[model samples]
Target: MHFELRDYQFLKVKQYLKQKFLLFSNGASQTSTNWLAVEQSLSKSNLKYYKVYNKIALKVLTNSVYNNIKQAIKGTFFFLKLDGNTNLLTKQQLFKKLKSVFFTLLSIKLNNKIYSIVQIKKIKSLNYRSNMSIFYQFLSANLKCVYGITYKKISKQCDLNT
Candidate 1:
């Protein structure tokens, strides 16, 4: 299946216009050959795309970020006892902790090569899309209340403790 940034519901035209470049990945399960088609399509288009020239460096960075987030989530869940007693914290409290951990981890400087958390936040605010399927899936698996409820509603309900 082909993925297009324009197809994402969260991406608006104004936000899309502001982007200097796009980040593309066919996903971990796909081979590098799959990206060749995407690269060729991009070459013919006006938009610029970020390419990972050093696969080793990119893999290391990706893994480091993934592990850091994973650990943060684990620690937060453990400290809050969300794993054992999901109702110990309200939904809002749980979400607040998760968001805090996510952003705090992002704020740390992993290396000179990667973009800063500030930049990432700016892009995210602009509605620039990233592959968050895995991240959301991870959160869903860990936090049962996150699945069905909206954030605004979550704040008003102590669903986690229910």
Candidate 2:
């Protein structure tokens, strides 16, 4: 499945951040209710927590991929060469790669509620596993790292353990 990032989330947050900062100054990032505040604001914008999560996932993944390939020849032409069903990952490591990607994601943001698998199926042609499994893989892979341990080792280990 092909998926697109709904800018609805970032736009909502960016505007909210602008407003909060307008009122509260730079302290907004450190606001006591940061997570709840973001969540509530998103919901108010009619973006479910899941929708924001899915869109964020889509944005991060697409941008990561686009950056990696943006310089390789004409990007649009190159991208069109592949099967839309053929995801960015290699054939052998679909699950492991997805786990690695999500591990990176949750580390940056932890409060996501698992939404649709559309963001995921778009990542690999493989139907893949549940987002909960992806989350477990993220946590189990990183529980030991104090934010800097190599995800390289963790992801490989996760692939093996799974």
Candidate 3:
């Protein structure tokens, strides 16, 4: 089934991504409250993330697009110190590479979200119990790491097995 993210959820994702480089939503498909928590966390952080829709790549550069690209190039040059490896790139080549990176980033701005949807679909379609269990185990482990919580300890504190 096809699904579209709601506007608030989309905004939440943007804010979350700005403060955090990545996001992973947990809970079954029936539960969307997890995303609400994510949104709240994002709001608290005052972070704003840029979104790039993966399905649509800009083929033409309108004035605004051109200006954005120019700003991106300038920002890249400002933040990126030229290293010895730059010796391998002529000024023209470096400019080309930066432009390439700008377009690439622009094209995949929503890549992580797209990829997450794809992964969620795969997880939902799984029929094998063992496979689902294994996937959940892996996800839980990763979540523990991301949250800096020791699952074993928490589970024990809650009187549950690790």
lDDT by residue (tens digit), candidate 3, 1-162: 554665444444344443212222211122357646544543333322233332221222122222233323222111122232322323244335444333222211122222333343344332245556888999999997966667666767889543
C-alpha RMSD (angstroms) for model 3: 21.6
If ranked by lDDT, best first, what sequence of candidates would result? 3, 2, 1
Clashing pairs in 1: 87-161
- Model 2, 57-97: lDDT tens digits are 33443544222311222211100011234334342443343
Model 2 segments more than 4 A misplaced: 1-68, 74-76, 80-125, 128-135, 138-162
* Model 1 ranges off by over 4 Å: 1-24, 27-37, 48-55, 62-162
Whole-model Cα lDDT of every candidate shown, in order: 0.34, 0.34, 0.36
The most accurate candidate by lDDT is 3
Q: Candidate 3: misplaced stretches above 4 Å?
A: 1-31, 57-162
| Candidate achieving higher TM-score, 2 or 3 | 3
